[model samples]
Structures are given as C-alpha cells and as structure tokens.
Target: MRAAAATTFTVPAELSAAEPPEVRGVPRDGVRLLVARGHGPLRHTTFRNLPSALRRGDLVVVNTSDTEPAAVDGHRPDAPAADAPPVTLHVSGPAPDELFVVELRTPDGRRVLDGRAGESIRLPGGVVATLMAGHPDPRVSTGSRLWRARIAVAGGLRAWLAEVGRPIRYSYLRGDWPLDAYRTVFATPGPEFASAEMPSAARPFTPEVLAGLRRRGVGVAELVLHTGVSSLEAGEVPLPERYRVPTATADLVNATRAAGGRVVAVGTTVTRALETVADPGGLVRPGAGWTHLVLGPDRPARVVDGLVTGWHEPTASHLLLLEAVAGTALVGRAYAAAVDRGYLWHEFGDSCLLLPIRTVHRAE
Candidate 1:
C-alpha cells in the first residue's frame, strides 16, 4: 500500500472549478463526493448525502472561522515603470507587535518573490503597507515570499478592509467572485474574527445538510481556526494560525468517543485544532490561541476518526495531514479515484470523505 504522503499525481488544469457550483447551475451540496474506506471499493455520491453516509452516534465537528476580505490593490511608490501592474496585497494574519503576515502578488496572481525589506506599497485611501522582515523568520524560504508588513489605514484596519478589501483570488479561479461566495455556512459572522482565506472544506455544507444531520441524529460542534494564506511550497510546513477549541465541544468529543461514536472533522482546519489540544490516549481538552502542530506520519491523529475535505493540489502540504488522519493508503486510493473520475479541485471544487474503516456504531 503506497502512502499518500509519498505518492504524487498530476491534476489536470481542466478539472479546476473556475467558480461556485451555483454559478455552474448546481446547488451548494450538489457537488460530487468520493468516499474512501479501508481497502474497499470507493463510493460515488453527492455531498448532500453525507448525513445518510455516517452513523447516528457520530459527531460532526466544523470550523467557525469567518472569511475575511484580505485582498487589496497596492503599488510600490518607487516603481520605475509608469504602466506597472498593481501589486495585490494579501493580508495573511496578525504577527507580533501589530504587524501582519502579508504577501505581495503580481497582477497575474503569482507570488512577488523579489520583495525586499523596507519596501512601501501605496494603498487606496492613502493607506501604506510597509514590508518588514520575512514572516516567522528570514531563514524560512517560502519561494522568497511572505513578509510581516504594517498596513496603516485611515480608520481601524478592520474598517478599512471591509471598505476596500475583496476576497483573495487565484489564477485558477476565472471569475472575480464576491466575498459571499467564499464563505461557508458555519463561519462565524463577527467582524472581529476572520480567516484570511475560507476554511473551504466546509463550503459544501448548506442549510439542507444541517437539517438532514439533525434528523439523522448526528451531533454537531464548532471551533475556530482563522486560516492564513494557504499556498505552501513543497516540503514547507504550514505557518502558525490562530485557533480556539471550546470546552463544551471538547467534552462532547470525549463523550462521543467513549461511547464508540466516530469523531468526524469537517475540514483539515478543525482536525488541526482538535489535534492541537488533544492529549495522549486520545482525550481532547479545550484551548485557545495559535497552533503550530503539523500532522504527518511522525504524529498521526489521535482524536479524529474521519474527515470531510476538499480535493487538494498535488504538491499541497494538506495532503500529508489527510494521510495522518486517515491512513495513507486510503488517501492514495481516493486521490487516484478522484483524478480518474474527473473530480474537481480547489475551494470551488468537489469534496471527499475519508474513513479508514472504523467499527460501526449502532443507532441510539
């Protein structure tokens, strides 16, 4: 059985979903889902069938991080060319001492790798984003990207972002989608808390799915993990992001597991948060703050028994986390089947549910 962490395959450009399912004449939960379990034949179904797929006693955990308008146009004040393209500044998240983890993107959506320290980019409303040193450390080579920058606006930063910022867009996504299209049903609605990018694995969930889960007796819980920009260089560990796991949810997780009910995480974000506060012997504790945990073969999942997630890029570091949560062989087979079956990729794409053949829990 080949491990997914070591297995690599090409995802065709045609399979990348250019827009939301609604724009493509499909419902939010109408996207395809491929279910993978231990050495069994893969099951093909739509995302809305999720409640019927799992047992009644199983608990579904979701991330409550809201999507932020992180993208804003800026240009270097010292640029020599008069017709130079606008530099797209992506506000990643907060760093120490009021600094923010930011990235400069070219007009075509490529990372600006040649950014030097002390460079200032002019923003709308006379705001200025001054680039500081490389984020985390100067030694971490992120394709020579990401900086701790200071963006000063007229009012507060939050007020300025809501006024001028838009959702971060990628070259793969064709349309300039509105911020609402990037949000998940479970995202927290407060302006004080926001994810630089959507916790997109949960994007397929709709009100219909929620009602079905309730009818089927599946319990739901929530935590928050405000994500940073998700572009990761090969072999680059993901940067630290803010997260909060509540005591109520933690207690519920332990209770569910003790009764032999599966603890299913809705996305990699929730899995990371749950695993961050989990103790040895698979007990979950409530906690809040930044999490630096990176799940790989070295540290497999101890709490989550199943995962619902989106199809990831071939080189994405998130693939390793899937291997850690649901044995590598399961992930490999699922990805292989997804590619062969024309499953779409990215935030606007289809999804997968990884369950490495757990014992069945009888309905209560």
Candidate 2:
C-alpha cells in the first residue's frame, strides 16, 4: 500500500533530541508542546500544561505497552570473534513458526542488510538466534531490512532481555541509557509485556502530569499495542501489529464522542488501536487482535477527535496517521512551525496536540 501525501519536511540536525530530557536538566514534562487547534493559530507551551489544552469531559487514551530491552549483541559462534563482528539484533517480536522478526544492525546503528538464512548468532546467557528467512516474504533472501529469526534462550526472550539487552535506539541518540529511562509512566509493570521501542508519546507524561489531567476532570483511558521496530525504511509500510482496546476504553470513547466531547489519543499507536475497533458511525467496541490499519487522508480517523503525539520523521508512516486525525494543512503547518521554532524531534523530543475542527464525518 502506498502512503497518502503527508508532511515531508526536513528536520535539522540541531533539532534532533539526542538524550532524555532529564539528562538535559529538564523534567520529562518540561518538553515543549506545540498546539494546533484547527480554528486558532499555533501556540507553544510546555508538556506539563497539557491538561489545560482540552476540556473537562475529554478522554485521553494511552498505550501501556512498555518498552523492552530488545537490543542484544551477538556474533556467529562458528567464526572467530575477529572474523565475525558482533551484530546488534533488534528483536521485533515472535513470528509465525516460532520465528521472531529481527533486524540485525551494526554497533553504529546501520542496518545489516547482508543477513543470510542459517546464520547462527551466539548471544550471552546461552541465547542463540538463527536467521530463518527474510521477513514479510521468505523468498526474498538477500537485501532484506528485517529477517525472520528464531531465538533459543534460557527461560524466555523477555527474561533474557532484562538481564542483558538495552532499548533499541538510532544513531541520532547519544550514549546508552538504562531500560528505566525508556519507559513511560503508563507502561505496565513487570517483564513479560513490552513493545520493541518505547511508546514515546506518553514518555513526557509524568505522574505529576497525570495528576494534572485528573484534576482537570479529563478521563484517561488505556490500551496496549506491542509496537514493532519504528525505523522502517522510507516508503516501507508498517507490518501488522498486535493491539488491544478494552471495554472500558471503548465505552469511554463512545460516551465522550456521543456527548460531544473529544477523544484524544496519546499517540499514533493509540489512534491505530482505537480506530481498528471503531464502527463506521464512530462507536468503538472492545477487541484485541492484529491491526493492519493505515490512517491517512484517504482513511482518516473515525473515532479520535484529537491527538497528543510526538514529532515523526517526514517520510514515516506515523505522519500519515497524523494527517488522518488532523487535516493535512494543519499538520503541515504545525510541522513547519515546529521546525522553524527549533522544537526537538524523535522519541525524546517535543510533543504536539492536534485538534482538528471536525474529526469524524462518515462518507455518505
């Protein structure tokens, strides 16, 4: 599937956030927020002021799929360490036939497109990942950005990750951080449940921010979308992802929209999950399954009225989702203003609140 036209602006190097806001002597909620209300001009503020952006009856849905330490270093055991350079494997998730969708990257974060099937990567704690085939299509063996691999580890992959793996990060990010730094306040506690990368929109939402939202009478809803690797090559559509929208969340969304209040999704993940379970009339139902939904100008959001999201790469599919919730004009304007004002980019960067004048109007 081809992507509809969305924002395709360039982000400057200085605007890319390289580390957590805490490392920069700023609280997570202190990151800048760009407000793009359809009827009004763009306004800039801090993330801590998010609650005031919406009305009292508004419902904010958040993704609880926590970030996992999925990046692990491995090398082929058959070759000498000198001959076989260690490859960093970013595990997406378990695939069919007990295989896992994995991307092998060099230490410098460059995609290793040369991964071949039958290659065994020896990892710490007796974990060995064997590449089975190229992902999406097993027939295409070479030049695949992602590979279908099987991991044989003690206990399980989740448990093994806790001990040795780090969060998957791109080269724009500087240095390594503990797994804790990659998690959001809404991330479910414990080890078994996690997303390959952080559900970054909620990263700046601290406990204090939650308290503020509650105090303002805004409802917080929950969902889970175990996201895969977000660094897909430009023009590559996102693969199917597992998501769950609970009965309570669906009920709240319907109630809020029915009463003329907005349902604000915390991120593109939330938007996708909610839209997947929503009916043509904008009513949502509880459901859990893999979603291949691609929101864009052609398939705009059906239930969500507003969005609280992070900056996305110009070519990234998430931008298409943004264009679905907010109109293309508003999204393009917001991104232009963000770039002009030097707002940060990436998971660790700033946030944007997109409130389109009208969100849902089913085709006649």
Candidate 3:
C-alpha cells in the first residue's frame, strides 16, 4: 500500500539535541518525559517516574537488538580520478548467500552514492562490496535508495566492522560518538550485531529505572528485532527487517492481556515486532523470521496497548504508528505540547508515553 508523504512541522534549531544527556551533564534517567493519554491534555514528568506511570501487572516489551557499526567509509576503485569523492556504506541487514542490504550514502550523509549495478566499491579494513541489484522488495518505491550487495571481508564482516565501521549518524548529529553511547542499558551482546541504528527509545532506561519498574510489579520482557537503516527520505516505506519473538515473551504478553493488563511497547521496533506476530485475538505466537509489516492508523493494533518512545521527526513513518496507538488528535496535542515546552528532539532527546485515559487511571 502506498502511504502519502507525512505532513511537516518546524522544529527549532536549538531544540535539536546534539549529544546524549550524559554528555550534556545530566543523569540518564533525568531526561524529561511527556505523558499523553488517548484523549486529554498532555502532562510532563521525568523519565525516572516511568514506573509510576505504568500499571501493576503491565508488561513492558523491549527490543534487545544491539546496534552495529554499520557505517563504513568506501571508495570506487573504477573511478577515473584520484580526487573522487568517498562513499559510505550503511549496512541495513544480512541478505542470502553472504550478501547484505545496504544504502550508499555520501561522505557527509546528504545524498545517495550513485553507482551502477555490478560495480565494486572498496571499503575500509580490506572489505569489498559489489552492488548486485536494487532492493529486492517489489513494493518498495522505484525511487527507493537501497541496494542488495555482496560483501567480501578478509576476516569476515564483524571483524572488519570492528576495525573500521562507525555507528550510522545522520546530518543532524554533530560528530562521531562512541559505540557505548549508542547502546541501551538493556542491549544484549550477541554473536551477530543486528540493528543499523540504536533503538533509541530505551536509551533513557537505567538500572535504577528497571528496579523501580520491578518494584512496582511492572513486568519487563525482551524480543529481538534487527532494525534497518532509518532516516528515510520522504514517502519511503521501510524495508523488511529480521525479528525473533521467543516463546517466553509471547506467553508473557498473552498472559498479561488475559489478566486484563496492558502490554506496552518500548519502541517502534518492539511495536512492529509484536504486531507482526499478533493475531486478531491479540495472541502472540512464537516466531522467528523477516517481516515487512508497516503500522499506520488504518491498521488497528491487536497486542500493544501503549507506547514509550522518543520524539520522532515530523515526517517520520513512525509518527503513523504513533497515530495508530494514540489517535491523530492526541498525537497532535502531545507533539504541540512537546515542541512548545522545548523538549529536545532526535535519539538523545526526551521521551513520550502514549496510553488511554482508562489505562492511566488503572495504573494510577
């Protein structure tokens, strides 16, 4: 299905957060939180009070996929001049037969790197990636910028990435940040690094916050969803990404719902993963596979009752998912409040919680 271009809004330049709160001399949980019910005036709070905002017996599902240093500098060996502009490879995810889905970005992250199919680009740390074809998904727009490429690294992809790749950064960020800063407190260390970008919604969570949630009887569970490169241009649907919803998470979610408890998704990644596996009866099944599921207002959610996420760009497809959860009117009110209150924007910015007024009353 084709989605119309999202409407735009003006975010003040000063509202763009250049660094994480820690780098800005604030504790992780000290970040601000904007709470919005399904229909009401938005309220402001601190991230540390997340537990108080959640109901007892509620299940908070999170994406434990760790961010990978997907951005690597590369050059075209076949270029005519030595002064050829350098290219950047933003690794999206693994493809079949040792190939990868990647987006070619300019060095400054402004535009796509133009190249023909069958051309080989030399990447740093002795890696070579050959552009094999355009994105395999037929539903993707003809103007979609992703490509399927075969990667050849001397010691393999992970080792090469460790030596040369950096976390994918957009034009808004000031400079490179350490891998530690990109990781969430609950990120799991696995053999394969999955996400092209950090699931930034959980970045404000800390051990203290987790303890508070536990003490408040709010159950937390994790699922894995290897997210693709975001920051898409206008009107672009996200490509398919891999996900694994374990039996434990599925059972917990179903149990919570059966007990008349809320199932809160910590990020859009979690919402996508859960909704992909949820049936109309609101039962989630154990599954492991790739999903191209896109959430919007037309698609009513089955399992997710609330969402905890960071502030998104005005035109982001994620805003559509937020609309699905909280409705368009509430989302508009919450966003207006957030912008007027000078809440920061981007990955390191403040967060918003979207729930129904009835659910908030139950939690309280």
TM-score of each: 0.95, 0.96, 0.93
Q: Cα RMSD (Å) between model 2 and the true structure?
A: 2.0
Candidate 2: segments with Cα more than 4 A from true spot: 190-193, 359-364
lDDT of each residue in 1-364, candidate 1, tens digit only? 1234665789999999999999999998999999887766899999999998888888999998899999999787665647555899999888988888998898789988878788888888889898877877866543457898887766688788999999998999987988899999997777554799999999999999999999999999999999999987777888898888999999999889888899999999999999999886788999999999989888899889999999998878898899898887788889999999999999999999998866544323
Q: What is the full ranking by TM-score, best candidate first?
A: 2, 1, 3
Ten contiguous residues minimizing lDDT sum, candidate 2: 355-364
**Residue 139 of model 3, lDDT score:** 46
Best-performing candidate as measured by TM-score: 2
Per-residue lDDT, model 2, residue 118, is: 84
Runs in model 1 lying further than 4 Å from the true structure? 1-4, 80-85, 138-143, 191-193, 358-364
